[model samples]
Target: MEREKIKRIVSKHRHEKAAILAILHEIQEEDKQLETESLNYIAQLLKIPVANVYGLATFYSAFSLGKKGDTKIRVCSGISCHINGADEVNEALKSKFNLEMGETTWDEKFSLEKVHCLGLCSIGPNVAFNLVTYPKLNKERIETIIEILHKRTGDSK
Candidate 1:
């Protein structure tokens, strides 16, 4: 599976060095995270050092070295969100899902992450679930979102 994905991404970018980031992005999109094997494969295909691939992957927050859940939730911790009770919102989510930042639920249905910003400061305290932004979050709203996700994913819990 990893080799096939790498081949497709390499082909898509025509193996150009300039397309490294795009190639990584496509790989991450498919795998939900970049594994060491895939990184080595990318490095071999691009004729770059594995260190270069590793460095690029580690430098970018968009890339994850660990496995991710089907649903990824990112809470904004920017100045605006922090001043607007982002902590409370985060706590509520953690409590509701029994998860911590950078953790996925045991069932692998959801993952929680804290991000610096969602780029929507005007609507502070933003939460994004699978890239869908929820602005001006509160504890009640968090619960609603979790329940909805559970239902949507067909999870009883």
Candidate 2:
């Protein structure tokens, strides 16, 4: 989770002595893909090119250059979810997070990402955080989730 630690981890594999792609792959696996900070740190620690890291990160959507959220809220915008009030669900989430699509909440507790499908069209209007899915969601339910999230974060910190 820390840059210096990532650098140190990557340092265990020397570029001249190790496989470049293997190092990048390993870094990506450990950090859920190349975060820009991790990428730069990895490059700096190993004396590799930043562009190489950037190139690899960009080459794969599995990579991310920025920070991810503690809770990733993915709302399916696929056709089935669309007809079943995905728009309303999307709006409610946006309003609740005070964010548009593809944005993370200011507190960094939640990030809203839209996907084409969640593979559950039969359960349309799907909303999920990590792995917990809520089907047939409404505004009221959305509000409840927000409240619960606030409380949970409050208690943890």
Candidate 3:
């Protein structure tokens, strides 16, 4: 199943000399992370060294080499966010999800991480849930958002 997906992605970008990043991004988007077997298959299909694929995967912060949860949550800890109560927002998320920075929930429903900034300093205390930034938040708003997400997924937890 996975092999066929990789083939399609590679075939889609077959003519490009620097399709490695695009291919990797597409794979990551599908699988939530880059697996070793997938990387090897990509290298073989692309006729490039596995090391080359691995290097790019490891170098990019956007790529997750390990498994990630269905939802990714990033809290901004930049100076502006800090002043605007990002710490409290982060703590609330930790309390609600039972996860620390760079940790995923046991259910694999959510991954919590900390980022320096999202460039929304004016509306500090920004949090990115699944890459969508929500600015000017407090503990209550974040918790409510989490609950809404959980309800949407039909997860009573």
Which of 2 and 3 is ahead in lDDT? Answer: 3
By TM-score, the candidates rank as 1, 3, 2
**What does candidate 1's lDDT look like per residue over 1-157, in tens digits?**
3698699889889999889999988888778888999999999999999999999999998888887788889989999999998988999988888888998877777888989988999997899988699998888888888788777887633
Worst 10 residues of 3 by lDDT: 148-157
- What residue pairs clash in candidate 3, if any at all? none
Per-residue CA lDDT of model 2 for 1-157, tens digit only, reads: 5876675666666444255567666665555435677777767776778888788777765455554467778888899889978888889888877877766666567778888788988977899887898887877887788789878786222
In Å, residue 84's CA in model 2 sits off its true spot by 1.0
Q: Model 1, 1: alpha-carbon shift in Å? A: 3.9
Relative to the true structure, candidate 1 has a C-alpha RMSD (angstroms) of: 1.5
Question: Over the full model, what C-alpha lDDT does candidate 3 score relative to the true structure?
Answer: 0.85
TM-score per model over all chains: 0.92, 0.71, 0.87
Cα distance off (Å), candidate 1, residue 66: 0.8
Per-candidate Cα RMSD to the true structure, in Å, reads 1.5, 4.4, 2.0
1 versus 2: better lDDT goes to? 1
